[model samples]
Target: MPWVFLVIAGLLEVVWASLMKESHGFTRFWPSLGTLVFMAGSFGLLAVAMRTLPLGTAYTIWTGIGAVGAFLVGILWLGEPAGALRLLAALLIVSGLVLMKLTSGH
Candidate 1:
């Protein structure tokens, strides 16, 4: 389904983003190559999902998913801050995405 593809693409966005950070401006060979491949795949899948899903709704979900995923990864793996405010913001992003999906007449 298009939604499945979109979710996968959103997850891939998270993967590529994490890999990109590890790539060290392309100085790290393996992570850089992985980043390039995953980035292209992520966008390709997003484009495919867009064929059936409304662009605005899909994009909002995609971005929301990416933001939350990245923040979680930063907190868990990268030693980034995990304060109450950060968690609240992440929750808000997820809530907004849910609201969009619930309200959209898909």
Candidate 2:
């Protein structure tokens, strides 16, 4: 299903973003390669999903997943502070994505 592909693409967005950070501006070798691979895969799948899904809804969900995922990784693994407000903001992102999906009428 297109939704399945979209969700996978969204998760790949997260992986690619995290790998991009690990890539050290593409200075590192392995992480850089991984970033490229995941980035391609993410976009490819997103395009597939876009064949049926509304463009704005699909794009918002993709970036929302990437943003929330990267933020959580920063807090949990990268030593960024996990403050209450930060957590709330992440929740807000998810909430917005859900509303968008619901109202997209796809």
Superposition error at 87 for model 2 (Å): 0.9
- CA displacement after TM-score superposition, residue 8 of candidate 2 (Å): 0.7
- The collision pairs in model 1 are none
Please, what is the whole-model Cα lDDT of each candidate in the order they appear?
Answer: 0.90, 0.93
Question: Which candidate has the highest lDDT of all?
Answer: 2
Q: TM-score of every model?
A: 0.96, 0.96
Q: Residues 24-53, candidate 2, lDDT per residue (tens digit)?
A: 999999999999999999999999999999
Q: What is the overall TM-score of model 2 with all chains considered together?
A: 0.96
RMSD list, candidates in order: 0.8, 0.8
